[model samples]
Target: MADKEQFFSNVYDVVAAYESGFVGAYGNPEAAEALRDQIKSAGGIPDGAMACSTYKLEETGKGKLSLPFLEILKLYPDCLPGGAQGRGDCVSWSSRNAALGTMCCEITSGIPDPNSGRLEGAPEVTTTARLNGVLSTEAIYNWRRHGGDGWSCAEAAQVLLNDSGLWLRKKYDEIDVDFTQYSARNAGLYGSRTPPESWRKIGENHRVQTVTEVEEFEALRDLLANGYCVSSCGSEGFSAERDANGVSKRKGGWAHALAYLAVDDRDEIKKLYSEPLVLIQNSWGAWNDGSRRIFGTNIDIPVGAFWARWSDIKNRYMVAISGVNGWPPKKLKSYGARGFI
Candidate 1:
């Protein structure tokens, strides 16, 4: 029997081949059919191989390859390295507010702190922690009821970091706030709208250094490489279609905020087919076929946690945030151009 690592390697190779247009062409019918024939001639995925859902197969044409990739990784829970499992939980609040606290915590304190009693370095950031770090949904609700209104991505990001010290994990009932009443804004300059003075009192230790106008994916990649997760504002209209297996696939969409986590370089595929993808940690729960539950027990994981095309990012507005102990030197050197201290 093949060991798990070897099994995963085989899966990776299959995916790389598919992405390289060898097994099946992605996004092309005739090419996909031709490639499928080639794969059959070469003997299809080996018997006893893990199978991906039909939806993933149709969407990426490598569903057979992709599904197993995620599943195999789950088998080795210890495989995730330092700070890899950011925040340890998914937030299901409004897209506008759900990610702020988690993103802030991820970029500032490092997820899964070894001292926090999690999976060694994988400390879980509670949903309560996220709520406390940001402007509470209760505040947003009250503001709107009094006719104050919505917040911009920048506002959400800034307020959370600026008030990190004041963040407190309250009982579920006390913090169970609603975001449906708030409106959403696509853009805002970091720190342009200061958080209310009252909310700003507690987070003296948390500070933000904002980097804006980052037009290149390489910069985003570099930031992730350096342990900094970026908060981006982009169109949410990206269609999220699910296959018969209920695995979610991204289409196109309008504006929203997302925390950029890691990138699956697939260097071999990029060298041959130019299809590098980004991994985003979404506030939504596990949207993939309902197989694994990400956060402790919540199953309604958002559908936003999925791999996305680089082009999808290029067509949208983006900004990167670096908190204290999280700032990369490249970002620091380029601060003169569109950066805010």
Candidate 2:
């Protein structure tokens, strides 16, 4: 930013992501990843990753939202025990609970993209979610906290990939939490250190199989468009107050993590945000104001979600996107035959 730089010193073949062939609107899934190798070889945003691609709209994926997550999250507000956090466990909340939960729901009960006009085919979520809802932040936070206030998304991802697998809310199959219902107090207490071995064993059954960083904005869009979830930690700051269209403007930088559940790159929203907006689901429940209206539609997004412009997220801010097994998302153990009371 301070100095105008043209090239990157080297190139990196980014690790592949969501290889089941749900590449965004792009023809080749590898196109965005290929741009990376040359950038490091050619250097610098491939002639500027931020500026060069501004307003490069994807007509197909405009206004993508995770409706399964929205309805389920609201159906069970108990899934979010404490509305806001008094400690620093956002890394777990963002990556584990919000991001992964969204992906899991999409896999298990996703409706055809809303644009498909097939809302009638949505799945029955009452089997597991009616009781405990989704993954527990209490089970996830402490492992990454390392007995401190903060942790990185990568550390949290490793815990999911190799350490302890996912732990559904306490009501169902809890990890190490002492109480049953989602507990903010428990989340704060475990906000540090690696979890106990028992937690590791319990979590394995539901662990996510893949998590890779996304460099290209559209690639990240594809992940969400195709029903994947992403968590990003960065220095970017944003306002809690949203505009009429539900867009949040840059306020400064907050060294924290948050989950992105949806992306709206529709050509029409530009009149309001001037660029595409990604809906960020914050760890602090009901913290941001204003409601999100799907662009060009009368449908209103439920509370607890807000939109952030892409311009605010370009470059330097790395995104960790994730997905589960199978094209339609397999049934996990948390809700195995023993599911529900």
What TM-score, computed on C-alpha atoms, does each candidate reach? 0.43, 0.65
lDDT of 2 by residue, 185-227 (tens): 5765543355666767776655555555566777666556655
Task: Please report the TM-score between candidate 2 and the true structure.
Answer: 0.65
**lDDT of candidate 1 over 1-341, digit per residue (tens):** 01111111232343232233221100223432443343346443211111112112212322111121132123222211111111101111232222232233443433442223222111233443332332223332221111222223343334333343222223323323232221122111012244344433433433333223234665555444433345555544333443332223455442334555544445543553366565554432332333223212233222335556677666543434432312221222444666764
Question: Distance (Å) between predicted and true CA of 80, model 1?
Answer: 15
What is the RMSD, in Å, between candidate 1 and the native fold over all Cα? Answer: 20.4
lDDT of 2: 0.52
* Stretches of model 1 off by over 4 angstroms after superposition: 1-150, 160-168, 171-196, 209-213, 241-252, 269-273, 286-304, 325-341
Q: For candidate 1, give the lDDT of residue 177.
A: 29
Q: Pick the candidate with the highest TM-score.
A: 2
